[model samples]
Target: MVNIILAIVLLIILPYIGLWKLFEKAGRPGWEGVIPFYNIYGMLKLSGRPTWWLVMILVPGLNILVMIGITVDFVKSYGKFKLVDHIAAVALAFIFLPKWGFDKDTKYTGPSASPEFREKYKIALKKTPAREWADAIIFAVIAATLIRTLFIEAYVIPSASMESSLLIGDYLFVSKVNYGARLPMTPVAFPFAHHTMPLIGTKAYWDGIELPYYRLPGLSDVKKGDVVVFNYPMDADSPLYRPVDKRENYIKRCQGTPGDTLSVVDAQVFINGKAAITPLNGEMKYTVQSDGSEINPQLINDLHLSDLTPVNNTSFKMNATVLSVKALKGYSNIKSISPDITPKGHADPLNTVYPELFPNYKITPNFPDFKWNVDNYGPIIVPKRGWTVKLDSLTFPVYGRAIEIYEGNKVQVVGKDILINGQKADSYTFKLNYYFMMGDNRHNSEDSRFWGFVPEDHIVGKALFIWMSIDDNASFLSKIRWSRLFNIIR
Candidate 1:
């Protein structure tokens, strides 16, 4: 994970210091580094390099190669070259320049890199020989692991499903404290790679602790209205594929805590008849996409809504619409209007949210499982061993699982398709237990809506803080949003 830290430091932390050195090293004013592309030219000439090098450096592959060489030469000239100097060349640009120029009190009196500077730079890194790759890999792995597990983990908001609550370009810090944290399920999380899976799952009360999140401690429990980041309930997405800070860990409000009966009527939220305080967590206004497509901006404006609000373009259902309902579309209603005022003026009445109320029903579990929806599945009273279940009481055509009561890890399968313990059972109880987790962006998310609840076995950790975030369009330098800099995830 040291590499991860280095990457951050070099990319973020070092620049401030390096920019100063860049000015001094160039023999120009210290503020030169703080300027735009001028620093590139300044550093190039300081190292006895050419202005053309800056243009080539802007090129993808060529720039990377040039930077590696320049870094070592730059630092050695500044007098910091040592065992770690090669890494400075390979990994540090911002650090080397500032430390050499501004910090070291050097001044840029030249137009470009001097021939002597380039020669010395090559010699410095060349002396280290084969250890370059090894050092870089070792440190990066250590940093990635530590950061991925205990500290804040970064993620991106993907779909517009959570339009009003999050934007496609938004990066977030998922606090792990809201839910009890889960130790690494997989023993060794290989740096930059997924090698193995962990053994013990989280406690029934500790699900969603899987990936990095808000839980700094293992004592907290996730409650309704709490925003959360969990493994995608569906398999269509992968966090790794997302951008470094933009990885897809959906940010959605917790509509239903475990065992909460979530429903919608006409559009307003009525929990056991009491209205739920309207939340802006699942709401947003419209904006244009980069592709020029019109859609909800998925922004969390910290604003409220009023009656007669209208929105469309995605799917939504009022999980808790205790407020007023105006224009309605598939599953979504307006939770916000022009600027402020929530549909519901009162705070969310936090209370126990139970599962859908249903009478006793029968089921025939098909082996290997069959296609089924959580809404229409047969309501099977959890079949305990002593309670006799009958074959005639089964409802068929649902997903099937072979009835296998095992001693430890081995479960026995009776038939490809059969009833459980004599009666039809929908879900099988585990030696541990299972959990149901769904994204608040109900329709747009690929969550438990498809694959089913997260078994206690798959939880990771709670998200904590947003370290960094930038959009695809923002400048590498212009994108840091200070308002989100250290905001807490409630």
Candidate 2:
């Protein structure tokens, strides 16, 4: 009890210890920085921010930005203008500010960013052989991390879900800034690990200080038919809670945006009742009949037909792009090629193999008759911010998981009546925008049709292009996909 009390007391007093010295350097009474609002008022005076901006401190999310701005200005007042200095001011202000304030040699020049400040404080790291290598590696990691977090990240296609449009082993540069870089919700995490730590198989992130979801202003809002990368929302089921940015990343085509009604009929997607434009490179699994002969290895290789499974001597199933399928039809041995469409009321064979699809929840008042299959699915309206939907047994199966899980609400069903958060409600208003994502290789991909809506917060960014592509099945010389290099993703 005494230790806990001491820790709490230390936490309360430590910030003031740093602030008092920092305040004294700013020509304010040292003791004044220990007071709550008075400390902020003193900071405002030192930062040169208008006193009216002080009111912003009371606001929740805005206060963080205001505090950051004020701190940056305070560091500028000390003539620290380098990017590294700004980073230190924002990230390690408590330690750095106190050190700068208390040190006899470190003096505050004025409220101006001076070029001389750079020369005075600039670190000249000792140039030993070991130090040179360490510095290079450290700076390289920092540069790569910054580029990944703020600009674009290198991604490898790990599955055939996108097939010819994007293949397994294809290296891509997903533009973080294109769809607005998502500020890390779990900032303190292992570098380069997604969800799990490498080798040891531990959680990759420390979820101790989770921040609310926020995206930097983007070049454009996600549009229908846009190739997108997003955190898998349903991964919320995987043992522990993961912040939005730390969840597993997935790549897919945006089938429906918020407010757009979406459905799949015979594997054709319709958005807002119009046929959505398809990607030129998009592919789907097809059942093809051939003239009872072995398929030419060269033909298969040339067309890049993935996972060609022989059903009989005369027929096979393969995932091929539209152009490849057209090319395959040139062979006289190929008789028929058509989409492997799963009929309505019947589940796809993958459904049996995969155990569960999206909305993979098992809740009471079970939606047993909810026979939504991949090829033929909802004409359901995609949930939009501020849109209200009548809640009942029928609609519950469609929107229940999102409302309860994603939106963080308590949903209950009592004798055919729906209640939200302990209150009887006939309708529920959506708090966040939602999106529907589908894979380009329609038949082979496990996507929104099998799962459910992807909340906007889960979106990662737009996939820009393939930087490199390699085919593992080919020889070393042929492994590199020369044509696919620098191919801009559509």
Candidate 3:
């Protein structure tokens, strides 16, 4: 609250106070400088800019650029034309605006945007090649930053979590406007970098200033089956403890939206008691049994089988799509193929059973009986905004992390009682909607099944289409996956 008050004083009040003094010098009523929209109108009149620029100032993202232009013109009208003067006027306006307004040497020369003023001082305003290049670079950086933040951004698939559907080398254009562009929570950051700088290996953003989470109006809400990109929620408690927007990015399919009860039974997902549509190219684990003969390597390559491990000369475990498993059954040497699903009430033998599959298992007393695995887990409810749930041993393990870490609550579990923010509580109301995400490569993904729900503020955007796809292991001649190019993501 103190920081917010200081920000208003420095950014809002002080600048307007300086503008009031400047208005008196320019033969306008000082009170006009303090009014909201009228102050912008006054600046436009003083700078001799067209009234249409005021309309652009009212736009969301474009308003930033318009304001910068108006500020520079207003400074130039006072005969301050140096690059440093313009920088100070925009960046340290509260300090410099008052400094210039009080200086007796400073005077209103002429309207900088007027034709007569430009003609009289044409030689002084002429730019050298270096200045022209600098201006062009500055404009390009600002424009590109706004477009990347508010419209669409290019992203490269970094892992095979969504394999067969989105390959490791697929480049996609994620649309920010689809589910509304989230404003930056950590606003002071180095340009063109997310959390860390490349090569230098240092933090790229300053965490001293943080804005509240907010999103602009969007075309539609997040829907089930959309390929969505979101910040990794566990990063909040990771060693670095990065801010929400600066967390690592992950892409997964939205299997369950807010207000839906999601579960996985026998490796198949169900939402609200209805079977969810599976990804057409989604992969799952299977155990293949064969005669005492070597399975053909060519067959393995043809089916895009992965994680192939020979249990013996006769049995092998591998990941394959449904179609691949069907095709393998037709082979003469292959005896039978069975899905490698962990049955209900059984813990996953391969992974650490405590917290990886059942999040907050170590902290909640009732978690030991969950016995859930990636293949057979949860009729858990996805949290929706304003929805309330009773707090108890059973539901605490399921929703504790979201309430405590994600929603910024103080939670303590004492024997059989729940204490929230120093008060005894029996229930919690979700402050934000959450979605359940899973990778299409079911056996390989560390997703919501492991970490719990993804808060709405963590959502980045909806994946639109793949613009490029490259196979790193392919020969140079066949490196590009041409068929996947420009394909819309389902």
Best by TM-score: 3
Tell me each candidate's RMSD, in Å, in order: 19.0, 6.5, 2.2
Q: Return whichever of 1 and 3 wins on lDDT.
A: 3
Candidate 2 residues 343-425, lDDT tens each? 87686675653444544434444554555567778777889999999887677878988999899888887777788999999
- The segments of candidate 3 whose C-alpha lies over 4 angstroms from its true place after superposition are 1-11, 98-106, 350-355, 365-368
| TM-score to true structure, per model | 0.41, 0.79, 0.93
For candidate 3, the lDDT comes to: 0.88
lDDT of 3 at 469: 94
A best-first ranking of the candidates according to their TM-score comes to: 3, 2, 1
Q: Who wins the lDDT comparison?
A: 3
- In model 1, the runs with Cα more than 4 Å from the true position are 1-140, 176-181, 194-217, 233-251, 267-278, 284-443, 465-469, 473-485
The residue pairs found clashing in candidate 3 are: none
Q: lDDT tens digits, residues 406-482, model 3?
A: 88888887778889898999999999999999999998888898888999999999999999999998899999989
Alpha-carbon deviation at 435 in model 1, angstroms: 4.7
Which window of ten consecutive residues has the lowest lDDT sum in model 3?
350-359
Query: Please, what are the lDDT tens digits per residue for candidate 1 over residues 158-253?
Result: 665553345456677754434544444322223434322335432122121122212234546655555566644332234332211222244554
lDDT minimum window of 10 residues, candidate 1: 351-360
